[model samples]
Target: MPRRLFIPIIFLTMLSACGGTPASSPSEVASPASTESQLEALATTSLLADIAQHVAGERVHIESILPVGADPHSYQYTPQDVAKVADAKLLILFDDTSYETFLEPLLLTAGGDTEFVFAGAGVGKRADLDLGGFDPHLWLDPNNIIRCVENIREGLTHLDPTGAAVFKSNADAYVAELQSLDAWIVEQVNQIPAERRLLVTNHESLGYFAERYGFTIVGSVLESFSSGASPSAQQMAALIDQIKSSGAPAIFLDAGDNPALAQQIADEMGIRVVADLHLESLTDGAPAGTYIDLMKYNVTQIVTALK
Candidate 1:
């Protein structure tokens, strides 16, 4: 089928999956007439906001606290950010507080009455990468994202019961898309030989992705799970040695991070620094504007660097 014709057919299938109800396209959802009646939601990061927006399906106005491409681990909250939290009827967050250090104080100050949900509540941590707690980058794996979808669906429904059916329908369609994404990722990763599936990143962000996709994480520049932590000279030296021995092709760096250290290591080691990965946040526009696009872009970058 032609691309133009295929698009509507996919949506029609989604509508059929929604029990034949005319599913409201995301853009078709009407905005609230007034601030008092608006169903406002806040997500801690852009990635979380994208996921929430899927289930919200025009029912809730979702805003992300972190700006586009900002580092979530070390983001500084402003007075205006606190106000955003206060204004939101619901706040959705990733479960790991360590990764979002600013949220603790911000929540104490302004989140007393605002209802919130943790999308990573029941997801298991990768044993090899557990620093002090579970790896909070669970969204890296589509399986974990499915759990996030469930939590988000329940949370949105709980906040606005009238939109429960819409939320469910939206989630079902999104989850199906995610399932296809997972399979696509598997086929893409298979392009790289099994022996070459070694990963070395700026931080331990890819633990869940590595575990889910059968890639071996050789080491990370920063040993900590959160990007806020600085690595000692010894740790950096040791990581360089690991890279040399493991023969990993590239050092995947989050676009939101400083990248100075990763670049330094890459320069010293004569390895490529694949700094295009959209780990902590999504892009401002096309290529990686959506969660699925972000994942596909990252996977393609990883494969191109390693394959």
Candidate 2:
């Protein structure tokens, strides 16, 4: 019942319904090349794809399964995505069980000698968090991303040992940028008074961010990492009370998810909704278009609202 397997089943059904023949026989179907002559990396999400692009540089071609603004928590796979997986030389997944529920079957079926690397695997999994599971949003912390970048560099080097030097150089430069970003965030966040450094988000997606930037999460309307779940009336009431008690300036929400509930909570609490946090996805060619920009945007918003 893996969602990824459903794509091939649907494709075969469509072919049968049309009485159409495949151009190539099953045995003759193109498989991923075992030799790393050409490097193709399939990343599970755009955020990871961006980081991989930084590490791979010109040595590899990178493609992402999730589109910009797509929710990784509820992304669905398609036939085209299956072909992308089948054609890649390396497959990089978040692997904190983030994509396992959906991408596991496609990965298993099409991985054929493909170098599969779990980018977050080396960061070690955390299972005791209170978001119904561990929080998989490790990329929110630049320090953690530094670790992820190292994992990516190792994965790329393993696939193309000849270009190992280039991968290392790229990773070093990107890691430096991440370090700078972390320092910059600390400086900017310091502008907010300690009492105002409270974050009340739509979901518990800002745990890593709060932990990194010295902000405390007062509460979330939905007490989970994903926005797919809705808050009950009791939960909503509790969040409103927390916001009022903690004096959180605004309720932050990601772009794609509906902000009605958040807006309602803000209205009842006499606070504002901070629509500037792009927690789950990047913006399309905006100031917050890239992962770096996304962090800058969120920090700016938090400073503006909380300070």
Candidate 3:
């Protein structure tokens, strides 16, 4: 139906000739380092870690509690993750709890003093994008990520007030980048004709993307938003019919997601399955490595498949 969808790191080791002892740069000396080491922040999900890193910059190294490329919808928390939660001074999680299967276990084991930041706490979600509950994949829309940056800025400021200015500067720069990414997505999506902008995903997480980018989500392979869910035969038949009728050319599966189900559905319609779409988590260092990269990669693939 109707939809709206919608980084850089530099480390310079400065050298000072003070009896071979290096002095801190003015920028670094200005921001207090006291709290950073004393209060470490960790992002519980892979996507949160990526976005949080952009906002955090050098203020704090945001560790990922969840492994890279893991599906948060069905991720199981390890004992090491519990220890990380216990030690973390602040934990960043997406406000949309429905999308994070690891949240409950993470919280139950978290220290009482551990601060929490909902990265997309203040962003608005479209009513059309609600799948069962609100779509937890808010990061799919670049505009929503603007608000995520803001939330992260504020949360980091709270965590280490001494780094407020640093956080603001990083967040502002990243917000501008996100705006550019949004514009780029619009430009790239234009390659697809409106009639051709139909999406059939492995999960129902693309609602925000479809609404923002003027595409229709024909439906997902899983009727639910979680990849862990299994579709009933009836549900599968309905989705197959929907995709066939909608003329959706391919089934979009997230990178590293099991494509057997989507492959089965696509086989029914004689359509292709577009695997390697990175919507859930970042990859090691290429293609969906960063949030921006993930969006660009997914958009390019979707446009290519649909156009």
Candidate 4:
């Protein structure tokens, strides 16, 4: 081989040694090992599912029984959902009977060895609402979510002792995030004057939210805790009178509920009606995608509407 041929061969060898491959972008990079191989958990709602995912991290696969915008208070469980629950190794549910009215019977009849972890564990009743029981919207308050995270962490650790450290670390980090979110929410709420911190929601969904924050529950359209119930003519008339006297700026409706009732009330009082606030379930691609995002989105909507 001549000198020119030898030099070309050397260059080809160097190119081959380097593989001549383009580097993978961040999106194209292989993800770390998924915890799908580990125990799978089923959460009753999307909000609870988000909390469980944050606590369990990649150590446990968390699935939500409710769809993106389904009303857990009125959602009927399908046979597929029952199968999902029965196949799960853990079940995370809110302990309120009114909210998750369908979960208890389904769990009992499903006949699975699924370990239970209640998000509303140790959480007491809501003194603000007359729903005949506890408020299941405890996740609205991030502090309550801290308790939920701890309960979920304990359950996950008990299920997989070897993953305790992972669960603890994730829970600690997530709790810190929740604390920061709580402080931010307080600051956001403070922007509105004390007199303007009045809220009128679709139902009793925001009892815990108003209690945690400084808002006053002026009235709800349904007067009941669950969205499945209907408001009587007398209740509607009374709520209209309350809104007219309270001078509340907006009627906040659940993202999943029909806003016709709220619209009717708002039309009567000439007040604004905000229907994008996610209360029970997280949105699929909406601004309120995660638990924290949902809170921030609601806060922004409230502050904007009231301030």
Candidate 5:
């Protein structure tokens, strides 16, 4: 095996032989598992991590694949990440095999029989808008996230059948919270005039939000769904024309995306770019430490900008 893959295989072999995850160098990928069979909690995105943390309660430590404040759309797993995922009991993906393409190697590393779950699988909507792929950002809508929570609850219960009651109870409670959020958003969005509720985001990151909350997606600064994809000159010109015609007040940029292009567009259009939306990841605390907070913060920003 290659050195990167070889190291993890050897490390796991040590875990089996010693009946524990052995001490290794600081550079080595530390398995969250204490024992070979213990579940090492892992989720594919920080936003997903926050959502799952509520359902998990105290059962397991749910670590995110991308660090706080990182953009998952452009994230690539390192060799260390492959090793960490090999020990996971359940891998939570934001989408099916289509989006989150960077995770393919990690899935292969985890082997064929390892359990996995797609939080947005049953979300019941996939558009061909994402550069010949389905847009998988179903969690943008709180209603859709209720479906995600259900899937997560099932996945966790599958791994730890003993905690079925706790998982179900927490999932029920969290889904209620999501419902409350959905209602709260309706009230808040009502403050904005129907015509003013237009979104021009950094990318095609707000389709579900637009669908759920009665906002129109004017256009995106980026032509493609993935933030990693760049816009062509023709695409940029089209987006500028759309924003001009729609009279969209702001270009909502995720905190992690490069702001120069958005800033340029805003300058040319004489509109401001709202760069505070925590669309991809949560922060350490405050503003957007949790999934609910992220939605509230983004909504508040949008309302302030457009209303």
Candidate 6:
């Protein structure tokens, strides 16, 4: 079996060793295990999966459909993925249609038996809300993440009532951590000269991050949030002009997405391209393995590059 399948198998074995019921297959385990009474959660991406893990603690089993290094913007569903979704007792996805175009069809085909939660739903409003649609990357802002964390806690509590206390405790602790991170980010960003607090990125994914951190979004190489959309000549020209005028030091790129366009833009405008911000997905084994680490790494890189 592939490593992905093998890891879950090992995980299941460990669960079994603890007297939890063993799942016959990943798909067969979505329902609550009568023996263990644990809810099975299927998160759309690794970012949400990490958050769900913290919220669920030992009460639920959480799995992510898109593996490490996979671009959520263009991910396609496989049969195995469909099975996993069908098996899940609860599902969590980042709203705003970032990478979930495949989800509706999968859910329709699989039926609506599974409870679904949109983590970004009902979160704080976006500052540069030019997204045309929702920006789905709500977790970019620590305050917004507090909402997402609350939603995850609610969903888990609803699914597994017995785990309500644990979920609440975990959510409270995580929210405190997020609050500390927000304060630290504000402090760190204060070091950057006000004029240098300009962010230009491969896409408009940083609007919330910039809004939260007081950074000005100079412009994006791609005019839209989704990487599927490309910029027209006029947009590109405008971005180049913004780069020149704002004196932004660097452009950030998603590690899994192609950076060629960002590179071209940087080359044309003579700006630096900061590497591997890990915007969409967490790296397999790095400083950005968790959502908190990803945010910390990004903020550190942004502050360093700008300073």
Q: Each prediction's Cα RMSD?
A: 11.6, 6.7, 9.9, 18.4, 7.1, 8.8
lDDT of 3 by residue, 188-281 (tens): 9999999999988887889889889999989987777677777889988899889878998888888777899899878878999988888888
Clashes (N, CA, C under 3 Å) per candidate: 0, 0, 8, 0, 0, 1
Overall local distance difference test of candidate 5: 0.77
lDDT of 6 at 260: 87
Clashing pairs in 2: none
- Weakest 10 consecutive residues, lDDT, candidate 3? 6-15
RMSD of 1: 11.6
For candidate 1, lDDT tens digit of each residue in 1-307? 1111111100101112322232234543454445345587899999899998998988898899998888887888998887676555677887746667788777655543566677776777554333545466888998899988998888898789989999999999999999999999999999999989999987799989998899999888788777867889999888889999989888998876678998898998888898778988999997789899999999999999898
For residues 170-262, could you state the per-residue lDDT of candidate 2 as single tens digits?
999999999999999999999999999999887788878888788899998788877777878888888878888888888888877678888
TM-score of each: 0.85, 0.85, 0.85, 0.85, 0.85, 0.86
lDDT of each: 0.80, 0.75, 0.77, 0.78, 0.77, 0.76
Off by over 4 Å in 1: 1-38, 127-130
Instruction: Judging by lDDT, tell me the better candidate of 3 and 4.
Output: 4
The deviation in Å at residue 246 for candidate 1 is: 1.3
lDDT of 2: 0.75
Looking at candidate 2, what is the lDDT of residue 116?
Answer: 63
Where does model 3 exceed 4 Å of error? 1-39, 126-131
Model 3, global lDDT: 0.77
- lDDT (0-100) at residue 226 of candidate 2? 70
Poorest lDDT segment (10 consecutive residues) of candidate 6: 4-13
Off by over 4 Å in 6: 1-34, 96-99, 127-131
Writing each residue's lDDT as its tens digit, candidate 6 over 172-280 gives 9999998999998999899999989999888778888888888898888877767778878888888888888889889988776678888888888777998678888
